[model samples]
Target: MSETITVSGVVATPPELRRSSAGVPITSFRLAAGQRRYDRATNTWVDNGTNWYRVSAFRALAQNGIASLRKGDRVLVSGKLKVRDWDNGVKSGTDVDIEADAMGHDLRWGTSRFARPEAPASPRSNVEDAWAPEDDAAGGEVTDAAPEAAGPSADPGRDAWAVPGDPILADGEPASSPEEPTQADVPF
Candidate 1:
């Protein structure tokens, strides 16, 4: 039986990334969660013990993990835990593995940056504004020579994240800046 678990620990080994014959990606790494205890006798903290886990991430998580994780970096992983007994001619033991569903750096120890991928193109042919007038009556040819005439939206291709009050918000990208994606934008 497998149960969901969340664990935070240091990466014990550098993540190994591999792809299956079918081209699916997978990244695996070892995690070490150490225990600390306060020693009243010595007036200091002491190392208690450590627990290790085998973590495996698939798909985009695997790609990200390979790019981001390094040995000794602190991270939090949430996944389904599976304990399996394995026997070798020399020895036999139980291995604890976590098939990671979500994982990220532990910000308590350090900081991390996030970069979101651009949305994939949809089937519907539409980049122009839906409500924009079909016909341009006001001499509507945007030229590089006269960017000011087009108002604050000088470049209409890349300003979805423009600030609400910024001059660039005149009439180009969406009014509201979305951090990630919305269900409506996805064509499925």
Candidate 2:
């Protein structure tokens, strides 16, 4: 049977990163989800239950998780349910895990912003300098290129340029000048 599950919980620990035999990056962590309840007689607050699930994230997701996540941070995880059974010298039982497809911080807790890091002024090696070239194709070293004239130029008078057999205007009609406008030209 196919099932879909989503859990929002606090991270119980920092992600543990490791590589598979194939060298794929994987990170494993535990998530703890809990809710509050009230006793009918005493009317005292109590934890209903805490569900702890092992979560695994792969590749880029794993890297992001390791960098951005911390213990006690709340996150939302969505993915398929996985159950594993293991038998060793000590003990064995089926453990529930989540093969997380998407995991991210619940931003309602806080907000953050990122700024781009400035490029290093001087590269250490020739190889690094060669890989990231400083010059344009014309071989001139580029400090900056003029932005406005960077694209193909168009004639000021023409409404639209015509390709060989394809004419811009239909039935040989004269092209509409820029100054002319109709009801459609009015902005809402």
Candidate 3:
């Protein structure tokens, strides 16, 4: 059976990073999701109960998540759900755990801007002629000129190519009429 699940919620606490017995890095945190609805009889907002999940990340993902996330940060987590059952002599309890495949901040709450760690050292080559200068009127240095306007001759012989009863194509094809096409005649 597939046990994979995805959960999107707010980080309930800062991620705690640790190493496994085999010395692999891991980070764990809790996520809380809540829903609200209006009660018809009460005419007030009602809590639809909150879902909490334990989330874990591994290696580089764990390191990044621990460094980037903080308490109350909204995030989307995708992974498999693992049920952990433990008995401490007297009673056994079960909890939901998520082995996170991917985790990232939910941008709807706020905006995050990232800057390049370092600027490239190499000089940029003028691969396009867009910046090449044109000769100035005084001939001292090159400069850009205003773009020229289209002339009457620009459309020379264009209209002559049209044929009578050829149904003048609007722009490229025949103009669409006001009538809506029926389902059978409609192109998918």
Output the better candidate (1/3) by lDDT.
1
| lDDT for 102 (candidate 2) | 91
Best by TM-score: 1
Q: How close is candidate 1 to the true structure, as a TM-score?
A: 0.64
lDDT of 2 by residue, 51-155 (tens): 889999997678777877889988999988887788887998777799899988886787533222234466556543444323334443432222223224533
Question: lDDT, candidate 3, residue 179?
Answer: 73
The lDDT for every candidate, in the order shown, is 0.78, 0.70, 0.70
Deviating ranges (above 4 Å) for candidate 3 = 114-188
Clashing pairs in 1: none
A best-first ranking of the candidates according to their TM-score comes to 1, 3, 2
lDDT score at residue 143, model 2, on the 0-100 scale: 27
lDDT of 3 by residue, 1-188 (tens): 22888777999988999999998899999999877899999999999999888999997679778878899998989998888788999999888889999988887777554221222244655333223223223334432221122233323222322232335331223445577789999888
Give candidate 2 misplaced runs (Cα > 4 Å).
112-188
lDDT at position 179, candidate 1: 88
